[model samples]
Each structure stands twice: as C-alpha cells, then as structure tokens.
Target: NTVPIYEGYAIPHAIQRIPLAGKDITEYLRGLLKERGYNFTTPAEIEIVRDIKERLCYVVHQNFDAVLKESVENTSIEKTYDLPDQRSIVVGNERFRCPEILFQPKHAGLEIEGVHKYAYDSIMKCDVDIRKDLFSNIILAGGTTLFEGIGERMWYEIHQLASSNNKIKVLAPPERKYSVWLGGSILAALSTF
Candidate 1:
C-alpha cells in the first residue's frame, strides 16, 4: 500500500486535529505525559525528552524488523491477506472468513476456524456416551458473545455446523453482558475452588 507520511513544519498542526475516541491528539498526549511522571520544569526539556524517547523507540523497532522478517520465514504456515471488500477468501490452508461466521460456521468445519466455532466445538466435544450424563447442560458467556443477535446466531450456527448424526445445545444467559462476571463471582464464592 502507498501510505503517506507527513514531514513538513506544518505536520504538528495536522497531528493536533486528529481525533481519537473523541479527543484531539495534542490533548491526549498532554494528558498521557502528565500521568507518566512528566512535569514541565521547562518547555524545552519536555520537547527534548519526548524527541529522545520517540527516536529511541523508533530505532529499537527498526532493528527488530529484520529479526521479525527472518522469524516469520521459518514458519511453514502460509498466511492470508483479506482485503477490506473481500472477507470470505482463504489464501492458504487456513480459512479467512470474517463476519460471515455469524451465519455459517459449517463453512469452516469441525476443527473450529475461529472464536465462535471454538465455543460451539467445546460444548459439542463433551462426554455424551454416559448412561447418566450432565452433557446436555452447556452455557455461553462473555462480552464478545453479548452483541445483538449473537446468541441466536451462535445457536443456529452450531446446529448448522454439526454432522447429521450429531446435535448441539447451547444455552445463553438472559443477561449475557454480566454472565462471565457472575460466573467468576460464583467460582470465588465456592469453598472448593
């Protein structure tokens, strides 16, 4: 990609206007430096310290890039590069489907391509062969799964992904938002834990 880097005297003014989480860049940096034990004895000292630190960090990262490149080559796994417009493309052996998994986990398979499928697989992998079993009871919790339509989508995906002979049952809490924290609280209360 041809990304542009700003380098003139006017770059500071440009950077000052950049917004992050509703705050400007200069305001964010000023607040960050204030929290990081940086007190302004003089304006010159502040600039000098910031410049030195920035240069040092840049130099360290520049040296590390060669090492990173060499390490990446040693791995046998092929990598995928998913474009913004193309989400469901698989470049190597690994599939690179993104938001589509909310609809079709079966498109990936039994091994579980990603997080949602992993959740489905974990429940399905339980011991169902026992005569008296607690295998039917399965729960889904966590902030990531608390998104709108996520619970039902996951349920449908699990059933769709399963083989014809197998069935999956995943029960999500009514308040999926606080389920993980509630589970943690229960675990902490247990004397056995």
Candidate 2:
C-alpha cells in the first residue's frame, strides 16, 4: 500500500483507487433510463442521460431501502424533466440510486465494494498517529463529488465503519470539479515550487 501526497505530504501505505468514477455514475444513469424504456441507447441519446444526472443526481444518507420503498408508495417523490425532443422522463429512485453506487456499490448492482469501506481501509493502513487527523480532514474532489449530500453520506458511511472514538469529516468544495486544478495552479505559482 502507498498513499499519495496531498498538499506536499505523503500518506504512506494507502494508495489504492476505488474503480468507481464519474463515468461509471453516468453509465449507471444511462442504464437506468434505458431500463425504464427510455431508449437512450445511441451515443447522442446517452448525452441526454448525462444531462439528467447533472441536473438531478444526489446521494441519500442511510435508509436507502426504506426510501426506495417509500418511493413506490408515493408518486410525489419522483420528478419530471423535459427532454430536448419535447418528451419528458419521470425520475424516481434513479436520482439517488445513481449516486448510491458510490456508497453502496453491491446494493446498487455494482460488482465492486463500497467507496466508504475503501476509504476506511485505506486510512486504517496509515500510521496511527495521523489517522485521526486524516479522518477528520477527508476531502472529496472531482466532478463526481459535485453530487449533493455526497459529503454527508460519505461521513455517515465512514463514521459507521470507523471507530466511534475518532471524529470524521468529509469536505467538498463548491467548485469541486475545478478545485484540484486550481490547487495545482496555486502550488505551481508558489515560491516553494
């Protein structure tokens, strides 16, 4: 295990990537729409599916099954979005389900494990002295992290997996998708660089 450095410090013994990514979530959304008989199979049609995700996807914290159950009994939980062709799609559980793959991969039909556990295991492999600091400063970056409530869900899941004694915090900047580049640019411009 080898942890990558962030802001100039190495995080030893913690460098494995969770295979899931933003594209995976896009594909998951595409598949969901297709399954609902939306016929978003063509390359062009898939773009519409991506738009749906950007506009509506958000993670749900805990009680995923219960929320799904409630969705079936309550039609109001769903939202409708207008397509370019003047048609519309009724988005239901797919909103939360799309992002849910990052949290509960298997429960969302993904073959891989959950990201929260991946994070927990990686942190556990680090030196005990900095584990608490690491846990309390978890940052979620990248386009996929743009999803609403993802940070909260991440904290919830990681907190559930981590020992109760340590405090956990997950932070996602407002411009998460660009924050990495922005940080790198700042670093490159610094005298230390």
Candidate 3:
C-alpha cells in the first residue's frame, strides 16, 4: 500500500510508491507466456493474464532461488490452471516471481528500492522522536498487500532495518483494497454539518 509519510506536525516527508504492482506483474506474466509459445493478443486473453495473477501470484519470503530453480527443472512446484476456454497453463515460478517484483523491482527491470526500503527510508527522514510511533503504526492498505505472505514479508524486511527498541507493526485490514474509499467516507461523515 502506497502512502505519503507525514511527521507529527503533519509535515510531508516522503511518498512510498511501488512501481511494479499487479498490472505490471500481469504484463510480466504475459511476456513469460508469450516466450513459452502461448501467444495472446486479444482483450479476453489479457483478462486471463490478470485473473491468473490475482488468483495465483504470491510472495516468497525465503528460498526464492531454490523455488525458481525447481520451477525451471519442471518439478512438483508446477500447477496447471485451467482457463475459461478449457485451456490450461502450467504456473510455477511465475506465481512467486511476479509478486517478488514488489520486493525486488530489479526483477521487473525497474531501478527502484523495494517497498520495505521505501518505508524505512521515509520513516528515517522524519523526526527522530516520532520514528517509533511511525514504525509501530504501519498501515498497509491496497490490493497488492492482500497477497498471501506480503504483510509478513513486509514486516520482516522493515523489522530488520528498525532498531531493537522500536516496536514494528504492519497491519493489513481485511478490506484493505477499499481502505482509501472508506477513509474518505469517514472524513466526509465527520466533517458534515
């Protein structure tokens, strides 16, 4: 979830933006499918790629290289997803690799820091006294953070960079994807005369 980091005085610090989100992952998966000789140019086919990403893509916190190697070797990691057209495609590393782009944008050919670094860096730019609070109240709200293991991975990465005295907490609400709209609704309600 991307957001503008602000200090205790409401001073804007930094904005954490993810360059390789779901859409980019879908495009990357499409490229991989094309390389595997599965050509798809139609709009329906594009939707299939998005479906596959949403239904299958996940984050791998550890042993990423091993999983990729197993996928390349055509091992048990592979699973066939049947499409609406009755066609099936084998998905292995693509599942984790796509989401991995969030943690490692270099995988998607992007030269930017990962989400964890972005968060930590933004917090660091803020005043020292409030850093602890910022670290403790991390709110993850977005479709990308909904991916399985994403919150855990983000917590781990951020925790690794945080001081021992700092309490790190990463919260991803159940309705995280709609959090922005929900927040707007709350503001409107409270501000109404």
Question: How large is the C-alpha RMSD of every model relative to the true structure?
Answer: 22.6, 2.2, 2.4
- Candidate 1 per-residue C-alpha lDDT over 1-193 given as tens digits, one digit per residue, 9 for 90 to 100: 0011122111121122111111121222333345544443466644533332222211111223353365446543233333233642222211112222323333323223434454444434433452012123335554334434445555565556565555445566777658757767987998987
**Cand. 1 Cα-lDDT:** 0.37
lDDT of each: 0.37, 0.81, 0.79
lDDT rank order:
2, 3, 1
In order of appearance, the predictions have TM-scores of: 0.36, 0.91, 0.87
**Residue 12 lDDT in candidate 2:** 57
Please state the error at residue 67 of candidate 1 in Å: 44
lDDT winner: 2
Give per-residue CA lDDT, model 2, range 77-130, as digits (tens).
Answer: 588999887988899888888988887777557787787887888888887887
- By TM-score, highest first, what's the ranking? 2, 3, 1
Q: Residue-wise lDDT of candidate 3 within 74-96, one digit each (tens)?
A: 75766788988798988777778
- Residue-pair clashes per prediction, in order, are 0, 1, 0
lDDT for position 191 in model 2: 100
